[model samples]
Target chain A: DQQVKQNSPSLSVQEGRISILNCDYTNSMFDYFLWYKKYPAEGPTFLISISSIKDKNEDGRFTVFLNKSAKHLSLHIVPSQPGDSAVYFCAARRTSGSRLTFGEGTQLTVNP
Target chain B: DTAVSQTPKYLVTQMGNDKSIKCEQNLGHDTMYWYKQDSKKFLKIMFSYNNKELIINETVPNRFSPKSPDKAHLNLHINSLELGDSAVYFCASSQVRDITDTQYFGPGTRLTVL
Candidate 1:
């Protein structure tokens, strides 16, 4: 079963615009959420993360908002750049921090 | 320097063959993990080793095994490989500081079983 889901398979946004990618989870036991950026022929790199205690987390031009009531989360990249065009994966950590469940990635294309 | 590295970036072998993939991390992290990405681009965790000890072993078949000789190295071995096992395998590591530590991933190893 897919506990985490990224409904949008692909997203296109103009450069310098705001790009919002959405994710939904069915499990309430997940306390930690993370976003990773992946490029072609390369491994995914950790981008940003949010804890259950906080509703939002921001790093540089990237921001993540979590809605515990709705079991939803989103990653927003303001002033999105062409370099940010890649696959974005939403991951969740259950009670066991050692293991993580990942969602099917969303391919984002930032047109310059 | 590459914090995490995996050898034989691409491997193509016949069914029933035995092969191994080596992974190493120079970041001095205590935890290492192995993940597989399928054709549909779904990434799933396979196994994890912390400080050279097996910590998490997913519902993978016994034909697949992970070996960690030290804290900085974790390797995956598959015996009697099947066509369904063809996928991209990634090696990752994270520090044991906070429960939400960030994981660093290495360039994935693509294995094609024919």
Candidate 2:
């Protein structure tokens, strides 16, 4: 079963615009959520993460919002740059779990 | 420096052949994991090892075995490989002691079985 789901397969946005990617999880046991950006032929790189205790976390232009009640999380990239074009994956870690469950990933293209 | 690294970025072999993928992390992390990205772009965890001890096994087939010679290394060996096993494999490492346990990934290895 897919514990985490990213319904949007792809998203396109103009550079300097806001880009939002959403993810939902079926398991309430997941306490930590993270976002990873992956480029072609490269492994995914960590972006931002939020703990269940917190509702929002921000770093630079990337922000992550977690709504525990809704079992949903989202990544917002403000002023999206062309360099931000890549596949973005949402991942979750169960309480005290060693492995991460990843979503199918959403491809984001930021056009200049 | 590369925190995580994998050897043989691409592998192509016959269905019946046996092959191995090696992973190493220089970050001195105690936990390492193997993840498979299939054609549908699903990244699923296969195995995880912490300090050379198996922590998670996601019900993978018996043909796939993970070996942790040391905390810094985790290798995957597949015997009698099948065409269905073709996919990109990624290695990741994290420090279990860290509360978040943020993992860093290596450049993936793509395997093609004919």
Candidate 3:
């Protein structure tokens, strides 16, 4: 069963525009949500994360918003740059677990 | 210096063969993990080790085993590999054995079984 889902397989946006990526999860036991960026032939790197206690978290040009009621979360990058283009994976960790369950990644392409 | 490194970036082997992938981290992290990225592009945790002790095994097949000789190294050995076992394996490490900590990952080892 896929506890986490990224409905959009790929998203394209022009440079300097705002890019939004969405993720949904069915597991309410998750204590935190995380986003990772991965390039071709490279391992994924941590981008940002939001705790279940908080509704939003921001770092630099990236912001993550979580809606507990909707069981959904989103990552927004303002003034998107080509360098920010990569496959984004949304992951969740249960309150009592140390492993991360990941969703099928979404490929975000920022066209220059 | 590489925070986490995996050897044999790409491996091609026949079914029934056995192979091993070595991973080492220089970040001084106490927790280490192995993740497999399948064809569907979902990263799944295979095993987790902390302080040279096996902490978590995600019901991976018995054919796949993880060995941590020391705090900074974790190796995965697969016996009688099957075609379905082909996937990209990634090694990661964190300061503490918690999901809240940031995990640094290696480039990954792409294994292909025929």
Candidate 4:
């Protein structure tokens, strides 16, 4: 069973626009959520993350918001750039677990 | 310097063959993990080793075995490979002080089985 799910398979947006990607999870025990961006033939790079204690976390142009009651999270990139084009994977870790469960990635294309 | 590196970036082999993929990390992290991405692009954790000790083993088949001789190296060996074994494997490392530690991943190794 997939605990994390990224419903959108692909997304397209114009440069300098805000890009929003959504993710949902079925397991409420997950306490930490992270987003990773991956390019073709390359491994995923850490982007942003949010702890269950907080509702939002921001790193520069990237922001992650978590809603515990809804069992959902989202990543938002403001003023998106072409370099932001990549597949984004949402991952979650249960409390006291060392392994991460990843969702089916969402391919984001930022058009210049 | 590469933080994490994997050898044989692409491998094509016939069914029933045995192959090994080596992974080494220079980040000095104590935890290493193996993840597989299938054709549908679903990434799943197979195994995790911390300080050369087996920590987490998922529901992966017995044909796949993971060995960590040291804290910085983890290798995956597959015996009697099947067609379903074809996928991209990624090696990652992290410092396990807490659950918030970020993991660094290596360039994935793509394996194709005929």
Candidate 5:
């Protein structure tokens, strides 16, 4: 069973525009959510995260918003740059455990 | 300095062969984990070790095993590898924390079994 799902396999946007990526999860037990950016032949790096207690978390140009009722979360990047072109994976951790469950990942392409 | 490193980035072997992948982290984290990414690009946790002790073992087959001699080192061994075992394995580590969950991952080891 896929607890976490990224419905969009790929998304394209123009540079300097706002890019939004969405993720959904069925496990309401998850209290911690994270986003990771990965490049080809490289490991995924932590981008940002939000807790169940908070609805939103922002870091630099990236912001993550969580809706507990909808069991959905989104990542928004302002003024998207070509450097932001990479696969984004949404991950979640249950309240009682630290083990993370990840989504299939969404490939973002920022065209210059 | 690489925070998490996995050796033999690329490996190709026969179905009945045995192989081992070594992993090391220099971040001084006490928790380490192994993740497997299949052809469909689904990342699944295989095992987790904290302070050199096995903490989490998923529903993986007995042919796969994880050895952690120290907090900073974790290795995965496969015996009589099967074709379905071919996938990219990632090693990761994180500091001991109950609230803040942050993990660093290695480049990953791509294994192909014929």
Candidate 6:
């Protein structure tokens, strides 16, 4: 059973526009959520994360919003750049757990 | 200076063969983990070790074994590989003392079983 799900397989957006990636989780026990960006032939790198207690967290041009009641979270990249094109994965960690459960990933293409 | 590194980026072998993948991290993290990404792009955790002790072992097959000689090195060995074993395996590390510690992943090793 997949606890985390990224329904969108791919997304396309124009450069300098906003890019939004969505993720959902079935386990309410998950208290921390994170986003990772991965390029071809490269490992995923940490992007942003939010705790279930908070609704949103922002760093630079990236922002993550979490809704505990809806069991959904989203990553927003404002003024997306070409370098932002990559596979984005949403992961979650259960309460007091160290291991992360990842989603199927969403490939985002930022067209210049 | 790569934080996490895995040897044999690509491996191809027969179904009945035995193979091993090595992983090391220089970031001085106390925890290590192994993850597998299947053809459908679903990433799943197989095992995790903290300070040379096994902490988490998912519902993976007995054919897959993980060893941690030290806090910085974790290796995976697969015996009697099956066709379903073909996938990209990633090794990651994190400092377990912090609750918000983020894991650093390696480039990944792609194993192909013929």
In angstroms and one decimal each, the interface RMSD of every candidate reads 1.6, 1.5, 2.5, 1.5, 1.8, 1.5
Sort the predicted structures by DockQ, highest score first: 4, 2, 6, 1, 5, 3
lDDT (C-alpha, whole model) for all candidates: 0.95, 0.95, 0.94, 0.95, 0.95, 0.94
- Chain B structural similarity (TM-score) per candidate: 0.98, 0.98, 0.96, 0.98, 0.98, 0.98
Pairs in steric clash, model 6: none
Q: In candidate 6, what are the lDDT values of residues B5-113, reduced to their tens digit?
A: 9999999999999999999999999999999999999889999998999999999999999999999999999999999999999999998764578889999999999
Model 1 Cα lDDT, one tens digit per residue, B1-114 = 999999989999999999999999999999999999999999999999989989899999999999999999999999999999999999999987775788889999999999
How well does candidate 1 match the true structure in TM-score terms? 0.98
* Candidate 5 residue A2 C-alpha distance from true site, Å: 0.7
lDDT tens readout by residue for model 4, B1-114: 999999989999999999999999999999999999999999899999989999999999999999999999999999999999999999999998876898899999999999
Question: Residue B90's C-alpha lDDT in candidate 1?
Answer: 98
In model 3, the number of clashes is 0
TM-score of every candidate: 0.98, 0.98, 0.96, 0.98, 0.98, 0.98
| Cα-lDDT of candidate 6 | 0.94
Query: lDDT value for candidate 5?
Result: 0.95
What is candidate 2's lDDT per residue for B37-76, written digit by digit as tens? 9999999999999899999999899999999999999999
DockQ of each: 0.69, 0.71, 0.60, 0.73, 0.64, 0.69
Q: What is the lDDT of candidate 4?
A: 0.95
Off by over 4 Å in 4: none
For model 4, residues A1-112, the per-residue Cα lDDT tens digits are 8899999999999999999999999998899999999999999999998999999999999999999999999999998999999999999997533789899999999999
Residues B17-105, model 5: lDDT tens digits:
99999999999999999999999998899999989999899999999999999999999999999999999999999986776758899
Q: Chain A in model 5: its TM-score?
A: 0.97
Off by over 4 Å in 5: A95-97
